[model samples]
Target: MRIDKLHTIDSTNSYLKRISKEEDAQEDIVVWALEQTAGRGQMGTTWSAESGKNLTFSVFRKVKRITISEQFYALMAASLAVKDVLSKLLIKNVRVKWPNDILTDNDKICGILIESVIKRGKLDAMILGVGLNVNQTEWKDTPRATSIKSRTGIHFELEEILSMLLKQFHHYVDLLLKGQFETIKNDYEQHLFKKDKPATFIASDGTQFVGIIKGVSETGKLILLQEDEVVNEYDLKEIQLLY
Candidate 1:
């Protein structure tokens, strides 16, 4: 694992993508920064890393001989990596929100963005961007955001956090490569949000319904058991999770 550390960048994920075209960077190339001015999240949401108070980094990994259905494995691996790191920091009640959000005590602590570029009927590469709130004690004017420092009143070195994350990420990637999908899937489900509780889901058609989150499908589609008679599976944009 080779890391390219930067003082500041607009977005580590975009930076890696730009350089990936010019140079053939190998798998496990990490790009990290102390600040991200234009950080991005899932569904084109803006991720704001408050200068030196958070962890903003991206990892590029090359994929071969795997179908797109297996891409969720990579996402699960990355989310688990963040979870492992936070667990080591003794962050209590850390859990993964389906698809890719890390939560602690039901508040969001980290966000993950996984982008895949497919060329020639195979996966060319994947950019995994992770943003975690570490030392930010207070979030100014944000709805439902919390940091490790806010929760624990302890500050952590950004470099030390990144190292721990990368170590766990590499280990999980190795597990994926070895075809340990069942193990990863089980662990992911164990940490999933609203695992056995009824929650509201808003569909693309603007209909709201209460359902139990069964788990995600192999292709990363969210599965919901609705009304004890209807089973619905949804893609990313098709459904939104609600309280």
Candidate 2:
């Protein structure tokens, strides 16, 4: 794995996406920074991290073999990688929220964003950006977020955590590239947060409803069990989960 260390960047994802176009860019490379001025999160929101306090990085994964339709498995691979790492640290009650937000004790500890490049109807490389709240002692703007140090009272070395995560990432993504769908999906849901539980949600049109989560479609749609024997599938941004 190649590491491109930077003192600061606008966004690691953006940086990698730009650099991946270069003829010299290597696969399995990591772009890490001490701080991100324009770190991106899901839903077009900005991720804010204090300089030199947490892990803000993006990994480059060269996807192969699987059709464009099977892209969601790549997402599962990225999510499970982080979940497996946190669990090994003895983090209590670790759960992967739908898509891939990692939660410990029901508070968000990490977020994942996967950006892919496709050409001529074939999939290419993917930039997997991971933002983890590591040693930060406090989270002011995002009160619902927590850190490893905040939870366990012990600080961590970021490089060591990154190495361990990459090993697991290689394992799951290898299965994905081989088109092993069931194995990845089963493990992902088993560690999924709020699986089979009734929860509240808000629709994009400002409609509020209640439903039970029935895992996700192979395409990454959230399957909700509604009233009167109704089942509906929603893509990202169509629905928002309410805590």
lDDT of 1 by residue, 1-243 (tens): 778989889999999998887787665688999888899999999998689889899988887745687998889888888998888888999988888899998799999999887888788788999999999877677667899898889988988888888889889978988899989988998889898789988888999888898888888888888885688888889988885
Superposed by TM-score, candidate 1 places the C-alpha of residue 46 at a distance from the truth, in angstroms, of 0.9
TM-score of each: 0.96, 0.96
Kindly report which residue stretches of model 2 are placed more than 4 angstroms away from their true locations once superposed: 24-26
Candidate lDDT scores, in order, read 0.87, 0.87
Question: Distance from true position, residue 57, model 1, in Å?
Answer: 0.3
Compared with the true structure, what per-residue lDDT tens digits does model 2 show for residues 125-146?
7789999988987767787888
The lowest-lDDT stretch of 10 consecutive residues in candidate 2 is: 19-28
TM-score top scorer: 2
In angstroms, give how far residue 133 of model 1 lies from its true place.
0.5
Clashing pairs in 1: none
Quote model 1's TM-score. Answer: 0.96
